[model samples]
Target chain A: MVRYKAIIAYDGTNFNGFQRQSTGRTVQEEVEKTITKMANQRVEIHGSGRTDAGVHALGQVIHFDFPYERPLEKMRFGLDTQTPDDVAVKSVEIVADDFHSRYLVKEKIYEFRVDIGKPRSPFRRFYASYFPYAVDVAKIERALPDFLGTHDFTSFCATGSSVEDKTRTIYEANVTVNEAGDELVFTFRGDGFLYKMIRIMVGTLLKIGNDRMPADSIPAIIAGKDRNLAGPTAHPEGLYLKEVRY
Target chain B: MVRYKAIIAYDGTNFNGFQRQSTGRTVQEEVEKTITKMANQRVEIHGSGRTDAGVHALGQVIHFDFPYERPLEKMRFGLDTQTPDDVAVKSVEIVADDFHSRYLVKEKIYEFRVDIGKPRSPFRRFYASYFPYAVDVAKIERALPDFLGTHDFTSFCATGSSVEDKTRTIYEANVTVNEAGDELVFTFRGDGFLYKMIRIMVGTLLKIGNDRMPADSIPAIIAGKDRNLAGPTAHPEGLYLKEVRY
Candidate 1:
């Protein structure tokens, strides 16, 4: 048996998320469908993580095992022909048998896009989150560093998550604002993230940046370890799994 | 009755065209449907020109008459709230009775996007034309000047167009290549354009740039004034009605 690892990019607007479910479409389902058509047999793919519904991805990683081998280029093109235009297998390479996509410990970088000040664009509606209110970049920048280092992110995690251990390490966090363009891109690089952790963190940052929450609310929220202590979760459409580094 | 002019933007992926049609959904149909709901009576809009199926627009101009006065912003928001996310009323203003959208003499700017030497993007498939070939930007730039000045563009116009006079003044033409990004954006500004003129021009220019046709072939093709003399018409998804200069 041969294992193949692939980097995938998806729009995620029409998808129910990256995981397979009983109903609705998912990115993993589309990939499996394409690979099955190529291999002429049922196949399953393992994704590194699960993004929520309406979330996009630039470099989500996945691995699958095939009974026989095929040229990577042929496999790539074959997958492209079968899947819809919104999903693409960006790159593929053969990997060791032990290289499991999810079990391999690695850092994941995520980007969240926000369109601010300017009117929302019809073309960008499916990709960017539109916020017409004012955003104070200085406040957001100041609060970003609070997310660095290891912490039990219980307050940032969504309620009802099956995840029991909430401790995770955030290697870096950044907030960049294109003032002229009225856009904001927040990036988070961590060893791992809990369910809806990044979205909750962004929402809390925005609340503080907009002066709805106290300037020093982040440390308190993290220490509180209560879901209700954090601000509302940001929309999923703006979140993207940007990269996975092993 | 009061006259209002609107600058609109649409993705055009789901639309049949900018004009009302009997079968498929159209940008005009959506706009009129929303306004009809607002005004409580039948109303029609006059657009600057018709965009073919699968064509997008950034600043398409349209004018219509209403039975009563309304704030421009309110009307814009109301139309947005009623229509699908793909179409947006970018701006609105009350215009004089003499202001006719289609009859006003002005220049129009059109843009064509080409994804050169890169894999097709999942998110941009509905907007950009993917040409997986190396492009010679210098060759395209050299051939562009030959297209400037007043000329009969019958060779560039799509066949079966009803317009008899194909003579149009080319105000400016520019070619820009994003070297790092492997993308090309071609802009054409003229008093007006023939049916698919910009697209045909782009295709012919690409032909020359890719060494399929001679660099000096443009002048001869324009002089020929026959539809058979020009290169193939480019796809509609890459064409955008960028702006209208009043």
Candidate 2:
């Protein structure tokens, strides 16, 4: 068998999530179904990680083993044509047998988009989180650097996350505004992230930007290791898995 | 009674069309329902024009009568809150008793978006038409001026349009690329448009851009007055009713 690695992009609006379940449509189920049909056999695929419902992805990675060899371009074309419109197989390549989509990940980059425009745009309702209230972008920018380096992110993680070790290394963190100056994009590059950690961080940063919370509270929040010390989790719609680096 | 004129925007992915009908959900139905609920009485609204299914709107004008006068801001807020998430009430104002949304329209601007990026973006699938083949934007730009000025646009009109007068004034026609250079937006401003006229014109222009048709064939097509001579109508998803002016 030959192992293949592929990068995929998906609009998660209509999906339950990236993981497969008995009910509800999912990205994994759709991709597997398409690939299995194309291969004329049952095939399972492995993903780098799971993204929650309503969260989009631009470079989600996955790997699968095929029974026989085929041209990479032909395989890519076949997968692209067979997959659902909401899911796109961007590129495919042969990979080493030892390559693991999940365990071998080195870094990850995520993006969260916020629409700061008034009278929220209908076209962006599904793709961006609307924040009509006043926000200080400069203050948010000043606070972004605090998220870099290693920290025990228990306060930022979702309450139900069962992982014991909450420490993760954030290599880079920054915020940028689009050319129109109506939207804010927060980008985070990290060794790993806890459940809903990025969303909670964004939520806290937005609160700081709005002056509801102190701008310099990240250190205390991380040291406290209590979820209640952090702000509420942001909406899922604005979050995107931008890249999974190996 | 007080007359109110409102500018509305909607994501038409889930809507049947702009006009109210007995069957599927429509923009008019949603807006009327929200107003009727707030007024505690049935309210009928007149729109500037109708847009087909899957066609979005950024500045659709509508006028309706209410039993009493309320603060314009309050009415706008109520409509914004009560309407579905995919619909937004941009602004509301009190208009003259004789003012009519449809009859007083002096101009209209429509936009058609084309996705020229390879491997179509999943996020833009519902908003832009994907053309993976080669297209020359310069050719499209060169062909745009031919659509300007007054002309009998019979060839650009759809086959089923019953309007006898096929003449219309085109004040401006241009094609612009976005900052990302992955999208081509075709903007057309005219006195009025017939059914599917903008879409047909965009379809023809895209054909010219792709070298499938002669770049200077627009004049002959307009003089022909035959729908068969024009290119196929573009997809409805890429078309937007950008503005209705008075």
Candidate 3:
């Protein structure tokens, strides 16, 4: 058997989530079923992590083992064509047998897009979160530096998370507007992220930008380690798993 | 009664078309239904023209008569809130009693987008038509000039169109790649267009770009006035009714 590593992209609007479950459609189930059908046997695939429903991905990593050897190009083409239109296998390559998609030291980048236009555009309703209220971009910019270092992100995590250690190192955090001037894009790069941590951070930053919360509250929010002190979780539609680097 | 002119935009992915019909859901039906509900009476709206199913619009104009006079802002807000998420009313204004949405139009601008990238992107499936074949943009640019000025375009018009004249003046025709360099955007500004005319023109231009047809065949195709002489009609997902001017 040969181990293969692949990078994939998916539009998560119709999916329940990245993980397979007993009910509802999922990216994992769709991919595994397609690969299994091609292999003529049951095959399991492993993802770097699970992304919630309505969250898109530009470069998610996965690995699986195949019973027979085939050209990497043929495997990529076969996987891309057999799977549904929403999921695409971008690239595939042979990998070491010890390579694990879920483990090994790595970094991740995520992006959140918000439409700041006055009247919500119908074309962008599914791809971006609508925020018509007034917001000061400078305020959000000033507060982003506080999130650039290693810290316990307990206050930014959702309640359902069971992980005991909430500490993670953020390598980069920044916000920028597209050329159209109608969207605010927030990007975060980190060694790891807790459940819904990026969304909570975006929600808090939006509040600060809108003046609903103080601009200098990030340090205190992290030190407080209270989930309630942070802002509400942002909508999942605007979130994207941009890249995973190993 | 007062006449209200409104600019509307719709995603068109879920709608049957812009015109009202007895069958599937349409943008006109959704807007008229929402406005009638607000007025508490039966109402009808007139559109600039009909757009086929799966064709989006950014500036579709419509006019309707209302029994009561309400603030334009309030009416716009009401229509926007009541209509389905796929439709949005961009602006509303009171027009003269004799103003008509269809007859008074002086110009129209349409845009067609083609994704020339490899391995079609999942995020753009609904918004753009993917063409993975090799094509030369300069060949397309050379052929675009022939489409300008007044000409008989029966060869470019789809067969379902009943319009007899088939003659239209083209004020502007151009093609440009987006900043990402992955999409080719074709823009055509003209007095009017017949059924699927823009799509047919794009299809023909793509053939010329791909070297499947002579780059200089547009003039002969126009003179032939035979629909079979033109290339296949492009996909409707890439076509958009950009604007209608009075």
Off by over 4 Å in 3: none
Candidate 3 residue-wise lDDT, B1-246, digit = tens: 999999999998999999988999998888989989888999999999999899999999999999989998898988987899899899999999999999999999999999886567898888888888888999999999999999999999999778999999999999999887889999999999999999999999999989999999999999999999999899999999999999
Listed for every candidate in order, the interface RMSD values in angstroms are 1.7, 1.1, 1.0
Could you tell me the TM-score of candidate 2?
0.97
lDDT of 1 at A174: 98
Per residue, candidate 1 scores C-alpha lDDT tens digits across A1-246 of: 899998888999999999998999999999898888777899899999898789999889999998898898887776766788888777889999999889995899999988773347777788778776777888888888888999999999999999999999999999887656667899999999999999999888888888888767788899999999999898998899999988
- Whole-model lDDT, model 2: 0.93
The lDDT of model 1 is 0.88
lDDT of each: 0.88, 0.93, 0.92
**Tens digits of per-residue lDDT for model 2, B145-197:** 99899989989998888899989999999999988788999999999998999
lDDT score of residue B201 within candidate 2: 93
TM-score of each: 0.94, 0.97, 0.98
Cα shift from native, residue B65, model 1 (Å): 1.9
Q: Higher lDDT: candidate 1 or 3?
A: 3
**Cα RMSDs of all predictions?**
2.0, 1.5, 1.2
Question: How far does residue B138 in candidate 2 sit from its true spot (Å)?
Answer: 1.7
Residue pairs clashing in model 3 are none
**Candidate 3 C-alpha error for residue A230, in Å:** 0.6
Cα miss at B144, model 1 (Å)? 2.1
Off by over 4 Å in 1: A178-180
